[model samples]
Target chain A: MQIYLPIAELPISIFLVLGIGAAVGFISGMFGVGGGFLMTPLLIFIGIPPAVAVATETAQIAASSMTGAIAYWRRRALDFKLGGVLLAGGVVGTVLGVAFFNAMRRLGQLDLVITLSYITLLGSVGGLMLTESLKAMLSARKGISAPLGRAGHPWYFGLPLRMRFNRSKLYVSVLPLLFLAILIGFAGAVLGIGGGFLMVPALIYLFRVPTAVVVGTSLFQILFTMLAAIMLHAATNQSVDIILAMLLVFGGVFGAQFGARAGQNIRGDHFRLLLALIVLAVGVRFASEIVLRPDELFSLGLIEIRR
Target chain B: MRRAALALLACWWAAAARAETMVLSLSSHRVQITSTYTGAELVIFGVIDNERRSVTRQEPYDVVVTAAGPRASTVVRQKVRLGPIWMNLAQRKFADVPTTLAQISSRPIVQIASPDLRRRFGLGLDSILDPAGYDLIYDPTFRTALIRLQREAGLYRSEERGVTFITPSIFRAVVPVPATAPLGGYDVDVALFSGGVLLAREDTNFEVTKVGFEQAVAQAARQHPIWYGAATALMSVAFGWLATVIFRRD
Candidate 1:
């Protein structure tokens, strides 16, 4: 069935949107990551306005992470101290991201920026994840244990404002952690991604946070950051479509449950490998869109110059 | 409600200044767009009273009905190839351009009247979009691009023989309004022609508006941005919590 989206001012097939949401939600649940990285681009491909797609996907991620944060909390896996420091920095990043979004739109370069960011970030993340997961799977087959965290001290260890996080058992400068979170929050707000996929790896490899606490800490930071993003996009850009978000949430929630169950049967390395491939596939698709010549070279728009 | 169906608003300037008179009525004066609204059609039917004894030329009266939605400033951008990537580099902005423009006539617009008359009266989409009040014509590149894009979007259209004549005096036309049409008052201007001469003309307008849930949602987003944003956040969070509780994988 077709339904008119009020804020987006467009008509779209309701079933298609739900289907996309379901597929992405299943991935999110299976991987224990926010599906924003996959969803925002899919929505754009299906002809939703880029601004609306980005903002609405954040709402869906917010919903997914809310449940995730709570689950980790009850299991005593969440690191509140680490999460709090990240949240403090995340707020600042969210504001800056939205401001940047508004300025790009004013310059009529928002689409270019969105495409560029997707290509660069997704390509790098996908490539890194693929190599790392493949190495882990290979080492496991040979019955070799995974190496310890890192051989030498990282450069970030010497930064100012050093603090201890007991939950992750780390004593490092809060500066790098805060900076990592700010980047994650900014990506979440502007790209409509959960940033968990990126954050989990960063926390493990860069900050040397425990793998057990990575998912929970990332979820905590994403939930609030996406919340702020949804509100800011609504207040400033008026791009958040509540009805669109609700439709996605319904499909995503159910898909996630089934996905989580399905994920339980897969090995850790195998699951990561699969997720990595999907991420790279999406990144490649975006790359092709940018490089390939389009059928139409002219685009039309209403310049609502809010003077 | 689908339509207001207001009573006929007859000719504003007809018969008094010319030999013939015309009266027009729309199937609906207002269209209410609810959630289920896909698209709608506005019916324009009218009659010509040329039976006056003094009126002699009655070869065949031709009706040209042009409907234009409220004017708004718009921009059309062209993408230039920058190495391997193509990006929008050149843009032309048109001020006071009709959001939607449709011309429906009994026959081809070109065959209806002289080029001078068509240009003067703004009879077709091309005529209506023609930049005015300058000895130098605006760049044809931008103008053609605007028409091409708008036509692709179903915003600007021209349909010869869209208007049908039931009798020698009565004619009817249907203007298809796509759901993507911008919300605003749409002006319908009709001009009557006979034997390559302008006989009578009349113009009236109607409105397209969102009603019910659609209206409420659109209004909330624009008027209470902060509240709307907060409510959206609250809803998503609650839904997430609910999903976790219901599923309970852990």
Candidate 2:
């Protein structure tokens, strides 16, 4: 179906859109990550204007994450205090990111930025996850137990703004958390993703948040970041496409529900590795787009319409 | 066990009995069109069958087209509403969007479907058609018909459809393009409705190109390479440093 908006419009199928949402949601639920990284690019591939796609994806992420957050909160898994600190940092980072987003839009460099960012971040993260998981798996086959502990580093211990997270049993400095939030927030805006994929890993590896708290905290932060993004897009670009958001949300909710249940049957490490591989595949596709010359290089300003 | 088996059979029979018998069929399994006309003519060709019982009088059905964006923020919207016309006499009724069929056909066809059936088998219709036991037809001559419609709607062609349709059911309409068209993407919505209710909606995108912008920028950037590179690098560093400062943990 085609929906008209004041700024732009694109034709889309309700079923296909729902299917995308379900797919993204399932992956997100299974991997304890947000599916924004997947959703944004898919939307662009389907011919959505990049700006509208990103904005709408944010809205959909907010709605889907709200559902997940509520469930987590009900189970007493949410760490509101830590989530608040992250959100505080996230909000500021979002504003900055939005500024950069608008500047790129004016220069018509937004697409290039998004493409480059996707390639770099996805490639690195995917490579890390794949290597680590493979190593762990091989060691496990030798009857070795994967070491689990915190790194005793002066950098982490000396950072200012120390806070205690009772649930995770950690007393860490807030600076690292804040910095992580900002990075994730910038990524969230630039890529039109919920940033949970990045945030969960950072929390686990950098801040030492327990795996249980990581997902819940990331969801909480994602909810706020997306809400802020919606408002920013609405105010500046007027790019939020409500129709697209609703379709994706409908699909994402059901997908998350099914995915969460299915996730219980799988090993977390294996799921993480699978997700990382998928991201790597997508990154390779993006990198090829940049490196490969097209049969016909049609350019209109910052937009390249390929035949 | 026998009683339980009998109960299950009864439930299955009850569900099967509740299915609708009347069927609707389109001449084409799919429809595709592209045009640049502001107001264009559109023609949709389809066939309907009353499978259970043939009525002496023609029944009314609504022909609707809807469009939505291919992204999450985009919405499912109705582009045109036509309906309740006598089915037999209006076997091939035309629905116009006031703009022109040529303009509407100028964009990609995302989906095409009918919604009256229980399963909603058609491509575009969501709430309007049943999915099972219906045949959608595609006519070869429809492309020529679309061209003729675009000529009637009054616009020059800029592009053509990248994909082909395999269905006999087709939809043709005229859409108007604003003079102040921006160089960006737009969603074209189409759908079919009956009795003030929506059947299905399809969305596709049409992009406006801003020719030469990339070349112009490249030329300018080359003229001031060092300055451009420095400015870009500085901005990136500043943004990165600012982010670090603001989001610092403590």
Top candidate on lDDT is 1
Q: Indicate the fraction of true inter-chain contacts that candidate 1 also forms.
A: 0.77
Candidate 2 residue-wise lDDT, B1-250, digit = tens: 7556755764674454332222223223222222221211223332323245332223233343322211211111111212421111111112211121222222232322223322332222222112143335543232233333434423223222311223323334333343223333444544333332333344444544322433233333445444433333233233323322443333
Residue-level lDDT of model 1, residues B220-243, one tens digit each, is 999999999999999999999998
Count of backbone collisions within predicted model 1 = 0
lDDT of 2: 0.57
DockQ of candidate 1 against the true complex:
0.50
Off by over 4 Å in 2: A1-7, A149-151, A301-307, B1-250
Model 1 agreement with the true structure over A1-307: per-residue lDDT tens digits: 9899998887888999889889998999999989898899888888789999998998999999998899889898899999989898888889989999989888888888988888888899999989989999999999997894668779888899999899999898989988988887787777888789889999888888888998999999889988989889999999999999999998898888888889999998999899899889988988887688878878877875222
DockQ of each: 0.50, 0.01
Worst 10 residues of 2 chain B by lDDT: B84-93
**Pairing residues by index, what is the TM-score of model 2?**
0.57
TM-score of each: 0.93, 0.57
List each model's interface RMSD. Answer: 2.4, 19.1
